[model samples]
Target: MEVSKKNKLNKIVKEIETCQACNLCKNRIKSVVSRGNENAKIILIGEAPGKLENEIGKPFVGKSGQQLNDLLSKVGFNPEQDIYFCNVVKCRPVRNNKDRKPNKQEIEACVKYLNAQIEIVKPEIIILCGNTAKKIFKINKPLKMVHGSCIDYKGIKLIPVYHPRASIIDEVKFNDLKKVKKLRG
Candidate 1:
């Protein structure tokens, strides 16, 4: 229906929760639509939900999420005030082997929701975290090779960065997150 701009956010979220738009819906415990200030200038797009996020019905709530919070704080971004967080896919793409990566079908299936979130949030800049996000945007370059650079995505400025979980394994990359604050300025 004709959801007004005021109610669009909540309405879209509710619709997503009930969405059978894709096969991912069948296994979803909850749809991780998005979180943070609706009016924020920047949106942080993650890959997908992990176990903690799925359980809490929130985006970025796991250990990686905590690291992400610290990184944001280092860059002076307060999620409640300055940033929006979402995933390219609303549900965690399942892997029977637990090591299998999310396949193209899963990514393609959920793209509509991701696009809708972007359309609704309408942020000035999008901080794309990790390879999944980069690939969705069609940037095939390695993350380390392209992180911190800004590129246009259908009129929005997209900045690619490492996923917070990556930092848990590499640690050195944590220092590079300072660049996020520059987008605020």
Candidate 2:
């Protein structure tokens, strides 16, 4: 079953690499696919690829990635071995030669890839790591009000959390992670 999942995910990754569903693809150096164990029970979904992530073709490789790694480590989770990381939009959104937030149309165009990933991974818990992810999921409430709470969405558990790139207040993030860990376990 795990092998099948990996195979399907690999095929999806290839599709994402060649994807021209949105204009973001035009400016991308590489489609940031995903990272971590394919069979992970926990999946972390961020808004989209940032500058460093776009440069490296890996999601969450910038300072935000480092912060996420540190937080995961502090919480006793191994990013590479325990959890999967991805972004709602695989390609970086660029405007005026600078990284910009993905627009609604762009996100709409790119969401199929993320949905494919969710179907393939079949994670028990999805950590929506920011407002964009929350918005995509139709989680309209502010992150502050729901960051540590879990919601059941179509038989899968969803947890909204602050984006790692957001203000780095360790205590707040840690508390949210604790809630996720508890819910995951």
Candidate 3:
């Protein structure tokens, strides 16, 4: 990455850390930022941070994270070197009952940061790993309908896939990831 780009990303991360754009920030323990190579060719975007991710201020560090990691290995991608992991909402959206999906307002508030990351990374492929991510990308179809298929959005290839935590875990999702690898190449 260029020095200027690195500096710009740092500036964005700082802004995210201190942002008070929505109510999600009010209860967050830490603002979960991105992890992995800044020059990564593939970016994996999830919906929001879960409990463990919130505690660590890192995206994809929970059970779902483990699943993702395994999937990456199976597809011959390196998390630390080839892919940048992030979430649509940087903070955990907790409610009275349990950690819940980020509401529309919260998603709206945090999307700018995600957009900034996309611009900075300029990834060749962006994996929208769940419904919320697909929604943000304006992909109206169900994940099952489009998962593994790459859609050209602007110039980037957007691949919708099932969230790692989704109830159904199967080889089809793994196949989808393999498709991602092929597309990345």
How many pairs collide in each candidate, listed in order?
0, 0, 0
Residues 40-142 of candidate 1 have per-residue lDDT tens digits of 8888888888777776778998898887888787766776789888888887666772423467888887788788777887888988888998898899999
Candidate 3, residue 154: how far the Cα is off, in Å:
1.1
Write down the TM-score of every candidate. Answer: 0.88, 0.95, 0.95
Instruction: List the candidate 1 regions with Cα displacement exceeding 4 Å.
Output: 1-6, 97-100, 167-175
- After superposing candidate 3 on the true structure, give the runs of residues whose Cα lies further than 4 Å from its correct spot: none
> Model 3 Cα displacement at 3 (Å)?
4.0
Error of 2 at 125 (Å): 0.4
> 1 or 2, which is superior by TM-score?
2
User: Candidate 2, residues 47-144: lDDT per residue as tens digits?
Assistant: 88988888899998999899999998888788898899999899998888787889999999989889989988889999999999989889998998
lDDT (0-100) at residue 11 of candidate 3?
A: 92
Per-residue C-alpha lDDT of model 3 across residues 1-115, encoded as one tens digit per residue? 4567678888988998889999888868888979888889889999888888888989988888989999999899988899998999998998883779999999999999999
Output candidate 1 Cα RMSD.
Answer: 2.6
| Model 2 misplacement above 4 A | 1-3
Candidates in descending lDDT order: 3, 2, 1
Clashing pairs in 1: none
